[model samples]
Target chain A: MSTTTLSKATLSHLDWLEAEAIHIMREVAGQCANPVLLFSGGKDSICMLRVAEKAFRPGRFPFPLMHIDTGHNYKEVTDFRDKRAAELGERLIVRSVEESMARGTVVLKSADESRNKHQSVTLLEAIEEFGFDACIGGARRDEEKARAKERICSFRDEFGQWDPKNQRPELWSLYNARAFKGENIRVFPISNWTEIDVWQYIEREKLELPSIYFAHTRPVVRKAGGMLPVTEITPAKPGDVVEDVLVRFRTVGDITCTAPVESAADTVAKIIEETATTTITERGATRLDDQTSEASMEQRKKEGYF
Target chain B: MSAIENIPAQGNAVDNGLLRFLTCGSVDDGKSTLIGRLLFDTKTILADTLHAIERTSQKRGMEAVDLSLLTDGLQAEREQGITIDVAYRYFTTGTRKYIIADAPGHEQYTRNMVTAASTANLAIILIDARKGVLTQTRRHSYLAHLVNIPHVVVAVNKMDLVDYSQERFEQIKADYLAFAAKLGIDDVRFIPMSALNGDMVVERGERLAWYDGPTLLDILETAPPAHTERAEKFRFPVQYVCRPQDSANPELHDYRGFMGRVESGELAAGDAVTVLPSGLETRVKAIELYGEKLPRATSEQSVTILLEDEIDISRGDMIVKTSELPNVAKQIDAMLCWLSETPLDPRRKYVVRHTTRESKAMLAGIEYRMDINTMERQPAEKLAMNDIARVSLKLAQPLFTDPYVDSRGTGAFIVIDESSNNTVGAGMIL
Candidate 1:
């Protein structure tokens, strides 16, 4: 109930990052007519939710919260997504890949194939169905090479395609979020944030996240030199040895492709320490699918994968 | 693993602050190589990434590792062996963090360079020592000044090819200084180094004993923070209006707060402010930052402001101190950089988005297009892509704005083609 005067003011990198993110969020809210925050219950999206709160706190968000469920995700993440949205009393719209498969829009090569890339079809369908003009995502520029080439407010064509070579020139903080009727813009507020920054922010803000991020004993199978989580959608293959190891997921994607690393860091502070010392990038060490092709991420992005 | 121990902790280094810089020069001036070396020397490049780059280098028929491959991440860039867009790379030394915007040096990609320079605190202009100063170097320098980058470091790269001659370095430096002086650039520094050899980039090499200057990393670590020269003036552009009517929290029933990030200066409780375009005056009751009330808020802090009296205010409204008001007008003259491939048509109506306001604007007249290479002005009827020209525009509504030379946050805007919805140009108010 008491106010304290801030003296000797010097803004830290985190403060600058937070302000920049909030500003971008506000720009999206002001420009886009039908906008939605893509919530996946990940650390980046959690930080985004916090920024949204700061940007528009005493009032409801201008748009709803939506999720494109891959149906192969961990229960912990989806549960956290629902609970967080409920607590905030915001509208959460969920569209699943299963629906796309049922509608014959997504055809997989095999039953065991990962549904990660096919989520783009479901996401596009959802965009068309709801007429979302803009989708605010938690993608970071440092996450991948293609993402680094993207503008903060990336524009998509009528078919929801990304053209890296031909992008709008984003100067200063003045982002051009204008789009045609069918065209939508994918806004990345935290594009400048590095992985270390995210963890540092998590530690500073004390944000709640899914428990799978911390080190825990979980059943897993060693495949392609990465530990693939043993979920119902991703069961162990023949002659695959399952083991219970102390591990944690640096990034959470579909269970079929997401991998975990061996670590004993169970808390946010410890995770920060681990992240600082680790030599491998989060995707390089944990993603079973990204290592297969060098241009896969870019190709998927062009097809409208967030 | 000892090398890993040598790396500084992220907590201490990042806390010192972050520096955003851009590297630009003519094509093949080793801009990517310089950035790659910085990352490599800082140990910020992961081992997996290094191995991948090495494999890629071998496949490209190179005997040694091609460090430039570390950047040039896109498939087209790998195949064409040229950087076509701006790529951002991050690294950290034990004392400071850096965000390097590696911009393409080709003349066609000048828009990309402008984009990078917009947010850069400093610029490292790389020049091949063999070719002292080319037109592209001058063009980049002009662009850097156009965006008001605080510091400019002229790095004469490929020093090994020129035998690391201090005479050549001094000659290049003198020529650059003369050119920069003409552009009114005061804070300019020069360094000679070989990005390919990792000399004078991160560590001071014995080969450069003749040249006594701080290494590139040292200079970056010691340079003063940016935007400290301008006099402080509060300019808060209302980005959104917050009014929470949730019954669960009774305290927020009648709350109406104007949300925005302070673009410059500071705002405190009880400070009298004026809303622009509307010309309504009020006093600041309190500043709220995410559920907590603060006595004051400084520049770059996103907070909600509660007014002592409720008034009709919405997005695109500027709130500033009553004594300090920006220029409010519908007709203005400015310099614009055309970004789209389509030429600028004087008869076309475009949308100009400035701060939080959007208005239909039409080009009134084309004064002249400046030749980036020679700094000569030539009368032009139409502006092609990547052309920098001085022009006059008439807006449908008055915009509260300032000259870019005074306040960058309040003076810049973008031109959008309404039909295609593509951002076609960037304009700086004169």
Candidate 2:
């Protein structure tokens, strides 16, 4: 083939996905005045950071990095988050669920209750404190059923509640990131990507991820039809079955709700290979929070959960 | 089929391009079944997801897997069991990756179809083989043509209901082509299939032997990607200016780069360019992608460009080759689609956001409003929900744009309601 034909055919799926993501990031920067990117030290957010770097480099990012800590997350991921922010020399803001609890905002029914849902409260409080008009997240539409219907630039009320039925009409590449005084827009740059696509981009970009994503022989308790990662906050009960099985985390979230799956994939290549043949979805195989009900994510999202 | 089922660990869909298309039809037309068949045949649905849907189906005492359960449950209320929003689904075949924008077709939901049609390269207008071409068919075809989708495939669904007759399929094809030609749609393909029985979707089942053409998946794999089908007129809109004056780093001083996407065409070093609205001309200094100097910048690549001459340019400015200049006008005539519940108040001023430029525009005049069902252009004073009208707009600032047909990136815009801060309308330059 001629060089022109080769160039035309060279724009692979990953290239198209990366360009679309960068375009979305730049749109948020151009439209919103004060925005912050919600970064968790997971594989998805790691890929998102690389996209942000590609979007605005040689200069600093247009927005700061913020994390709504559940206060029950793995220490390794949080440590990586801090280190990555320090290396980039960008501002990092962390507001915890503990802070919200002390402020009488987040209330738990039991002492051992999961703090994952309360992250929304801390996130909204942080948004109010920082006066941010847009909050860029690494939420993908393919992750769960509820996110599939969300727009690229999602609108939130003053209470941070999302009205799924009444979303703005996003047309062509022209995004509507405008919001009123107390309202905000949740901008998702990677909404079009899937699990394997994220893995492909990470492998192609050679991005670094948290170590917990790789397989390791870790002790875990089996519950919620998933292997719950044994942690200080949520330890195994007397009658609970515990095993030191080799596993890897598909999604790295709050330790109280995030679980690991039985896997031997220690590298990105192996993980991609495992993902292609696996019958379970990323969330279905791991996420302990989603086992409650089908409408739970939608209900929580309506109440300002990310 | 076995080869597709066993997806390879390496080199998965890297050699092929991506196809983004939308499926348009009502629930009665078996639209959901067709989408489900595509995902199922390609093995995109995992075991856990299929199991969940199977349980839901069994609970309702229905036989077999309820394929509609794959969609229609997210964000949309189940009062009518109809999906209202445009839910996007992704699946990959060995040859190409697909992004299916599942949109509903009711007169009140015209905005959803327009939103999906805007980004789609092709549209699958599903027609029930028994009912032939209905008003909904015409609406979808018209909107697809209006959005300038390059290829449209009219899938005559429910062939099993019509006993897989070639005469019925040909009759429906004839009806659709007659309607398509009226709307100036030149590139349309027809397929006969039964999504429930799995005929002609992925595999040519035993029934459709009389027809000899590419399957739906076959046609989508060869469809051109977005920018290749359009005219190559280089139009770059300057989004933001990057000036990193880090005194700590000596090499970063006095560095100013124009940050934006290459909306169309391509650019190389030493190409003479002009900054619009200022009319200042300069040469391309360098194109930087993550601090790496690139030899050329093509369409849709978001990069920073440094000009040889230090001209005063900021956001809302257009960068184009002096050879090919777009029309710089303060007054634009467009076909605008009303997307909001609030009617258009002609006396009020709205914000016209086109490319990177934002201008205050007024509803100067409404030439005619399109009745979506009847396909008639009627005189109207105001536009309500799902209304398309040819209107005259006077802008507070000049926007350099081309017709939407010729250049999608530089020609489309959105109107914002100032009081509510809502995107109320979508406009395409005429």
Candidate 3:
């Protein structure tokens, strides 16, 4: 490449966003004492992995990767998650809602209940377990109303709750990751990156992602104006017709709650093009749990959900 | 597909994924109202939040539910119906996610707006149709441009005030275009809407049938976010020096890595680079991300770099590709936007924190004051709050830098009043 080729190189907005995200990841690694990357094996987390690689590839990262499992995860995602972590030769730590429940730290009203909200208990326990001062996440502002209210370095109380009212005043690019004991900071590296940015970056970087992100023929049943996968965990109800449809997940959450959207855009490039004309916000299209009054994002963040 | 029974009840290693964004505009322009509408319409508001807005609106004797009440959370702000602090509101869409920094619209709060927009990829600039392009609008636009925010959405609000006329929208659009061109803002988008009546905001407006474009929500969801990586000049300001103190980890103990984020450009191991301020030279031996080593590091990625030689470097100094070195200087001229409540005193000295470096700056001389409304420049001796003027400054030490327009990460700095310890002004290198 020519040295003075400022405009010649094929550098898109997505590339810049990825580079910025990677930089943020490195900053977290360099600045924080005990940093752990929160990886859910979702598209956003997949994008964060690419950033982490770009930020620190030839060597191992300073911190290990962690996940707060809601016990109701998709088999495809969890299978791909373990395989990818093993392939990279990186440490992957997991804390489960099932364990939290067993320990009596998390209580449920029903045995067949959605364990999505209970993941917060496991997350706080994991934070305390590792003494993690900074937990890097792939939560995008464009995803949820409460995530939008978050600062890049969101401060959480000792109890792992987010008080939006008591956020630190972030001036310029000077981020104060400083916190007292037991109070960890949730650092969002790609906080500024939109959903489209994540997809585009994924495509441009040729990052490896799980098959669940792409469109596939799946047996699903329509419920709550969305398609819920006909899994045993969230089986088809009576009077519901299970049909095979080409669908893709805009976001990957608990298998029982995250719905799939009807899409033929199987490739990353196709997803990018489809994302360009998408009118419905990403969260609006795929989350079965988010379609209700009880599982609002703002409330989730306040209650210590990522 | 693996059967749910066959699938292990495994939660994949949790990765923290989140997003962030910023919103800007003046008070009367309905900036806060737009945020309120987004939160309200999206069903993100809780019963307590609704009750609070209702109580506040009722206290103010409003007929309808005041949506702006959701964002204007300060006592003085609610009383005066103005946003003073940067009110952050979070909401999510189905396809993706977001973080909205609702910044103050008043000219005096430009510094606060700058602080908010500094880290934002997209900026939504609200424009009141009745007022067209006001001085505050220009200042906001200029700040957006100056800060190098990749996208700008000109939400021309209060369309109902002008009877939702396309002609008025076109005129205001033209006026903004003319002014924006001077500042070199390329991706300027104009969206005309009545934030109050829900026109072209969340939903399409029937009145704007002549105009065909996606709603504000549509644009926000679809607009290309600013790209982060590409072939560009590599600029890294050392923020820390990482060397393990433990002798047991021999490899880590002697590992001397200069850590910083690539402000712009791609860098590879073995790329010849130079240290700024000292003008020393070195080549990248290795790049570290966490404990892993990388062959390359690009713009915006934060990583520690090991050099071929042990060069004298610290937190304030910068590392750049030797081929693209910035000019080093002690004296410089820049456009200053006074941000303090206290007036500017030429004799008073303050610290200028630029990039990752800080230096004591003395006011050398004032050149001219900028008339934001008329876009005119006039000679001035002193600047008060919200005043934009060209000023010459002499630094206590020579610094390596570039013009703000050329390199945003390296060219910008903020003036801190040593007495009150508040950031008094922000400046762009000229």
Which candidate number would show the highest TM-score if scored against the true structure? Answer: 2
TM per candidate? 0.97, 0.97, 0.66
Provide the global lDDT of candidate 2 against the true structure.
Answer: 0.87
**DockQ values, each candidate:** 0.60, 0.62, 0.08
Off by over 4 Å in 2: A1-9, B1-14, B227-230
Task: Give the better candidate number (2 or 3) by lDDT.
Answer: 2
Model 2, span B28-126: residue lDDT tens: 899989999898888889999999989989988999997877885653455568877888999887556789999987767999999999889889999
DockQ of 1: 0.60
Candidate 1 deviant stretches above 4 angstroms: A1-9, B1-14
Candidate 2: pairs in clash: none
- The alpha-carbon lDDT assigned to residue B328 of candidate 1 equals 93
| TM-score for chain B of each model, two decimals | 0.96, 0.96, 0.86
Provide the lDDT at B213 for model 1.
Answer: 88
The alpha-carbon RMSD values of the candidates against the true structure, listed in the order shown, are 2.2, 2.1, 9.6
Give the per-residue lDDT of model 3 (tens digit) for B1-430: 1111111111122111223467788658888788877765555555545775688689889989888877755334445666656655555454334557788877666667877876677888998899998888888888787677878889999998998889999999999999899978989888998889888887786888877977888877764443332345678888766665556556665667787777777788899999987889988998866566676765555677899998888878899999998878798899888877688898888888776677899999999998765678898888987788899999997777887666667777788776644567878888
Candidate 1 local lDDT, residue B307: 95
lDDT of 3 at B398: 76
- The digit string of per-residue lDDT tens for model 1 on A159-180 reads 7899988988898898888888
